[model samples]
Target: MAQDNSKSELKLTKYNNILHTKIYRIEINDYQIVELIALKNGEYDGYLINCIWKINKNQNRTKSITQKIKIQNLTVKKLMAELENGKFETIPDCQDLKGCIEGLDGTTISFYVYKENISRNYSYWEPESDYYYKDKIIPEILQIREILKSINHEFDLRTSFAEFRDNLPKGKYTYGMVIIEKK
Candidate 1:
């Protein structure tokens, strides 16, 4: 069953209000990255990087797109102000991932947020593992992912992730996603 998230969405501060994020993900055949950054002056920058190495590593195809998008939305603005005003405190670090405990080899997801001076990441071993679905999913993390995904809708940043998740071969597969924070 899909977990209830409405109440969790109301409390972004409960987890943390983030502005910049760097999501690095790995799967059996590909590696992808999503970066989102926002500065104190209200400037926003984003990038989507995808690398799919076929069965033959030498035949790898990589695509990287960079954009300094102009976003105009009140909900986005309010979310930003919440960061600056402290209604949402910045989550300087990643949460401890507790969902990857089955076969020793499975998919792993590591989400992170970094600053000029430091970086932190949250990791989940494999969404297909025994303990995978049991983890206390963070509604805030999911919210941030959606926000970033929406901002980069033109790039079609999410379809591939969903595809990969849906096509996982059993060994230990998981969904892939990322939300970047920028200060």
Candidate 2:
């Protein structure tokens, strides 16, 4: 099956007291793997996270599969509280954060703020460690992973790269990407 690469606008019609909005878009095109939409919506009532992954590396196109998972109100309040505390802000010195991890590879991670209409993206090699990643990335990743586990979506993270990739499951063969957008 063919994948749709077009962009679509997000509509918010459910909750009126939208505390903030976050959109995470991860894309790794090394082996024709694209995960373009990972949206996390945090409102006064609850939270909603929608993630989609597409893998098309097989020679036989019919063997490819697209995985879509929706997580609703499962520890979203904790995530929202973290965001409210400014845990996603970029650190002043990238080198300091790098010390926490070793042997960085060629992966890309992005953080977009919908309310401010600003985005900050960097590759694995660019920063020593990301402020947002250090502060709340792990918890955020674990939150989703735990939820995924409960629903029988299991994947392993053997290396640092794998750990990072597993945090955001949207990619194909050699490369993986994860986007975190907060308003």
Candidate 2 Cα errors over 4 Å, as ranges: 1-64, 83-86, 92-106, 123-183
Superposed model 1: Cα runs more than 4 Å off: 1-30, 54-104, 127-131, 134-158, 161-183
Model 1 lDDT-worst window of ten: 7-16
Compared with the true structure, what per-residue lDDT tens digits does model 1 show for residues 2-71? 1124213212121112543322111221244444445445655443444322122332222222122233
Clashing pairs in 2: 97-129, 98-128, 98-129
**Best candidate, lDDT-wise?**
1
TM-score of model 1 vs. true structure: 0.39
lDDT of each: 0.36, 0.32
Overall local distance difference test of candidate 2: 0.32
Q: How close to the true structure is residue 42 of candidate 2, measured as C-alpha lDDT?
A: 28
Top of the candidates by TM-score: 1
